[model samples]
Target: MTSDRITLLIVDDHPVVRDGLRGMFAAADGFEVLGEAADGVEAVRLTGELDPDVVLMDLRMPGGGGVAAIMELTRAGARAKVLVLTTYDTDSDTLPAIEAGATGYLLKDAPRDELFTAVRAAAEGRTVLSPAVASRLVSRVRAPGGAPGKEPLSAREREVLALVAKGTPNREIARELFISEATVKTHLTHLYAKLGVKDRAAAVATAYDRGILG
Candidate 1:
């Protein structure tokens, strides 16, 4: 394991989930839980105060929710990276979170090792996704005429889209492609317009319908 410990902040409403993540990360080497929050507002406050390197943020909190907190933090100029941790993987949540500047995403049910890897990858600015979600994103890019005369996305776009469908964030995408975050946004914007969609899930569906992501 690497000698450097990645500082992590857990932000989930459920006490059990927070406890579980805290236990899991605590037992693992190279990870330190900087703090925990039970709601979005608290999450925002903690982010400003603690400045953890990575935040495991949940999407649907009672007061503000993950997207709200993320937007607030970003607007406030907090540089901490946000990694979505939620039970729901719908595009509604994924797209908004991505647009709001989350750096990565992971399912609640992911295996322990994969979760650890994802957290580490997020801290290092690499996108992580469950395999099933990746396939869906790939499909959206492959759909024909999805972009209406726009050239099909390059192999890298397809790769990036696959990860996007799985809810991976730009930081992770940049690391995965060995490129800059600005480049990833450029591709995503171009892909969004081509696919005639506004967000990650729509892009994935369009690609699948066109038979590109497959």
Candidate 2:
């Protein structure tokens, strides 16, 4: 937001990574490194305070993780676009972050130019993804049950999802349904796969969006 330069907030647990990103953005002409955070909690706090145009967030860190922070930020309607920057390109890492409301996903090994372009795209609220991540996502979409709200949920899965939509905790849901907590988790997982969502909130929202929860 400083005139034409894109403002950035670097979030990573490693000091070296943060330093490198700070230096990289600082040396670039069209970017300004607003601040750095060591974990997701700090990242959220600083995002509230600094109001950066884009956030370069890392996954899998102590204190807090990136997906949870993305969900929290999205829930709070943060202005900054979160562009996940991490070494993780696996489905478990990628889908959750995207579902949690990340604007883009990039591997840590991305080239300097690619990284800059991603940040710029994210700052403009465009979706960005590294080549590998994009390919994986495409493959996932081609897989069964990959489309959100398309696959029909089983009776038990529907029951679990309905309970989840009410914001009921897992234990309570299990008790109400006369099922074990593990069974509830299994049902949730199955429903999540069928719904093409990663967690409870997304499942409920997607179900409602698709008229499955109405």
Candidate 3:
């Protein structure tokens, strides 16, 4: 509810994306688009110069990747909050950017309102994540040993997890497996314990991340 306008620097390798974002933010109230950069190196330089409140950063670039820029920004104690705006939602992409000090992670497919909300939250130094990214992170923390380990999932559990990854509901999974709903729920609980997750989405993310599912 602060009356001050939030400043932003849009960093992306694609010119079309930059133009679209710049236009979107320009049309929206309470935000000012400071500048645009096509690579991480330029992004870093601009961030230093503009000192924007939030930086909409893309992951992959030619000169330097977003993760590297994020790390550099953190090391340099830059004031802008980096909000990763990328198409990748996998652990390989999300984990590194976050660990490198990105303030938030959002997918390119997010709704315009969601993007605005994420930027606002990031400007205030709050953590924001796309739903898929959040589930992946939660799955990582809940996974046994905090990552893929030697404790392998059981064959039945693997089957259930595979179906879950395919967006199958418990009832559907049970019907397909010729098992009762209660049995499916039991299998899910056991798998959750073994995988160190609390929900279906997290289980799927952890499975994919751990190579339990392709």
Q: Which structure among the candidates has the greatest lDDT?
A: 3
What tens digits encode model 2's per-residue C-alpha lDDT throughout 98-208? 879998888999899989988887887766766566545543343354455566888888888777654467888989999999999999888877767665545665666
* Candidate 1 residue lDDT tens string, 119-142: 876776555555444444443344
TM-score comparison, 1 vs 2, better candidate: 1
Ranked candidates, highest lDDT first: 3, 2, 1
Please estimate how well model 2 matches the true structure, expressed as its whole-model Cα lDDT: 0.83
What local distance difference test score does each model get? Answer: 0.78, 0.83, 0.84
Model 1 / residue 126 / CA error / Å: 2.4
Residue 66 of model 1 has an lDDT of 95
* Residue 196 lDDT, candidate 1, scale 0-100: 70
In the range 1-214, model 3's lDDT, one tens digit per residue, is 2358999999999999999999999999999999999999999999999999999999999888999999999999999999999999988999889879998899999999989988887887766766578667764466454453346778887888887765556778899989998998999988887777777656766666666776
Candidate 1 — worst ten consecutive residues by lDDT sum? 134-143
How big is the positional error of residue 161 in model 3, measured in Å on the Cα after superposition? Answer: 26
Model 3's alpha-carbon lDDT is: 0.84
In model 1, the Cα lDDT at residue 16 comes to 94
